[model samples]
Target chain A: MSADPQRGPLPAWSLPAGETDRIRIATQWPEEVTREWAWGGATGAGVRVCVLDSGVEADHPLVGGLAGAKVISLSPEGEVVVADDSEGDVVGHGTACAGIIRGLAPKVELWSVRVLGAGATGSGPVLMEGLRWAVDQGFDVVNMSLSTTKSQFAGVLHELADSAYFRRTLLVASAHNMPVESYPWRFSSVISVGSHEEEDPFTFYYNPEPPVEFFARGVNLDVAWRGGGRIRATGNSFATPHMAGICALVLSTHRELIPFQLKSVLYLTATNVGGDR
Target chain B: MSEPGRLQAAVAAGVVGSDEAYRALLQSIVEVARAIFGARASSIFLLDETTDELVFEAVAGEGADTLIGTRIPSSTGIAGWVLVTRQPLVLEDVTQDPRFARDVAERTGYVPQGLMSVPLLHEERALGVLNVLDRPQQARFTLEEMDLLGMFANQAAIALDLLQRARRARALVDHNASGDTAAVARLAETIETLEDERRAAGVRLVQALDDILRGA
Candidate 1:
């Protein structure tokens, strides 16, 4: 097959770069925002995080307990339907994401918002409804490891993302694995993440680029799967939850911080920014 | 319908009128992708939206002989997942994973240990999927390889989109042949035999006429 002239040699948002310029903090703050300071001793207690993808397998050993679980689907007439998720994790993707979050912030209140069904497939309308529900419920952090390439959903998703930001609900989205454009990851209001090959779960870097803001460990890690199983997988999908889990930890400690402030704290604590690279 | 008007409709739809050429293009895509990835097999499946099924359009390596035109539910396998989510995926140790849809793989007569699948996307619409199964050396696919596979899928998607348009045009032409548009069908067949440059000129002329007619 002929190469597409538009796409670069590497995947979107995976470009290597030198260290970024550090952000100068005001002298008024006595303590530096180290990783310990950002999430030190924080177990994500009382923080509500929503996994907005396929349903998370209930009682999965690695995932522990969930705060709530809901499934969003379409009716025969093409209307959105929201119901309790009795059937857990049609595919293992959501479970894998939830397990990652659970691993980092063990005490975070995890909620499963099942937007994708079997084979990890669902319509764009269903995805929007799921996100809207999560935002309306005021989850502290919503981990969206999936995105819609359909531009028709962009406007609505953008509005929802902005609304979440204003409501103090941080949306952590994964950049599309392919180089193609997608949302709501591309929106400035949301924190977009990509994968890094590093093994450290906490070793994340800040991208100097605009679209994908961060990269976390997503290559070849053992993740929780459906039927209470575990498997090895890799993608930007898994990286998103690591960021979300970190967000939960930060929110758990500093309850008053808004989305933007929380983002600044993350940048300050990033391995490239504060920790030893 | 007037000759220019009929030709304009065909041209407006971007019908190339060559099913053989489209199949050949897809065949080359699978072969090249298989070779590039050094995989045991590679194949492309076209989504039949009407039936909600995926039809194997082309294959290289294993199952190339009997796999063409095979139909499977578009809601079941890895290809189905890619089609619905419009995302690329990579999996290792497919046999051990319960979510791998082993029944579907068994039906196809080839069960892979590892696989990577990407949606063949035309704009936001997913035309189908391109799957590379079981690379020789490694069980896991790197992020870079997934990007390369996506590039191949893009080209395949464009060709598939054109092929679908051609099919629609053929059906339209056939439906109109019994009526006064018989001459238009004849002209379409004639245009198919023309050299590349002349055929392109004919297409451009038809498009211009279509624009004028639409304006009028």
Candidate 2:
């Protein structure tokens, strides 16, 4: 069916009814891979999740006690400086993401990699350094709620994303809220996410489109903010962490699942794909 | 004055032929944005790279009178965040958020309850920020609203870029001329009247000339 014209055309990375197709998976096992088998009852225990954004507030009630936190900054001499993050959540954006992940995967080890500074202002070099550090740490999942529009950093981001994928560190990145070109999220190696209006955190959809792989709840979320407060927020920024939390859940149960395998599990168990079954 | 010397004098003076048209364009953008979002106010802040500050360039509704030409550090508030991240942000309750930079808002004499800010970007470079503050309904900003705001910011960025280029061109022309800046004024007017594609091409040509003149 054609999309309703009144809705002002379908958004990018969304599939119309006519566009969605059913595909049969040829699995070695006779039983179909269901949501129950994938992540049900999985508390994301033993999974290491790195939130690569502004720092997270360790004391935020919704996001209790981070495993560790680090800040990426440039020294006066232009050298990359990685230091302990004593000051937390410069803009509350990272704390919001971390809180969502914590809510979904309570037992997961959450680490904060502060890339953005106060008021969420950050440079591309700091972001790249932060991502590189996260990749080196080999976190089970990395939630990147922010992206750099600078094309100059795309090459390095692409390499880092691929390295994460190969090393079994699933990178969950938020698609730009605007229809603009951005890095890492657009890379095939990452799980690119967009927003849906649904309130259920577990409800997610796998887009037939290539770039944006999934859609999750991101509208009007009451998320934890800095200073142990909560605020209403929206954007693809929040949706990405939901996917990361889910990834943590899957990895928690099936430690041997690689990045590509984890992605396949997500697609097969998406609300749209496996809910009815 | 010799040709080279005249050009040098104009460049040093930072002469921008009349800025009436530029101001009018930005004013129209903020007005339309304010109306579209049903917001209490809308404003545009252009980054002054030399001073590392954000200059209030246009406004509709609140702070339209005394806020224009006011400067704040480019890295101080939500506008700075948008500028650095080149991303759109929507905050529902600015009053409770520390990142709202209340001190800066207090200086402007209007602190919004909620705000949506987007980067005014020309290609990858962020030229400024477009902010829509405190819609009467206090409704949460939707993804669609953010997307529409981004489109508006793109248009604003192009106009701002052209205005900056016009200033440089006016400097070069005003310097060589013996107190007459009409040539550059006519060129700016002509460029503004061109079709979208041609206008962008024309702006590029002017920018190239400006770069070459500066290098000389």
By summed lDDT, which 10 consecutive residues of candidate 2 chain B come out lowest?
B8-17
lDDT of 2 by residue, B1-216 (tens): 666554454543343435677889999999999999899999999888777788999999989998999987876556766676665777777667755546656778888877788888777767889999887644555777877887898889888987877666665665456554445545666786698899899989999998998995
Q: Pick the candidate with the highest TM-score.
A: 1
Candidate 2 DockQ, CA atoms: 0.23
Q: Alpha carbon lDDT of residue B80, candidate 1?
A: 64
| Residue B115 miss distance in model 1 (angstroms) | 1.3
Worst 10 residues of 1 chain A by lDDT: A19-28
Please report how far candidate 2 places residue B180 from its true position, in Å.
13
Evaluate residue A49 in candidate 2 and report its C-alpha lDDT on the 0 to 100 scale. 99
Residue pairs with backbone overlap in model 1: none
What clash pairs does model 2 have?
A: none
Q: Highest lDDT among the candidates is held by which one? A: 2
Model 2 quality (TM-score): 0.81
lDDT accuracy of residue A231 in candidate 2: 75
Give one digit per residue, the lDDT tens place, for model 1 in A1-277.
3224688344434433531222234333336777777777999999999999768887999999788899888877877889999878766778889999999999999999987652223467888999999999999999998788889899999999999999999999988766567889999999999989889999999988778999998888888887787877777888999999999998898888889998898888899988652
CA deviation > 4 Å runs, candidate 2: A1-30, A118-122, B1-18, B98-101, B138-140, B170-216
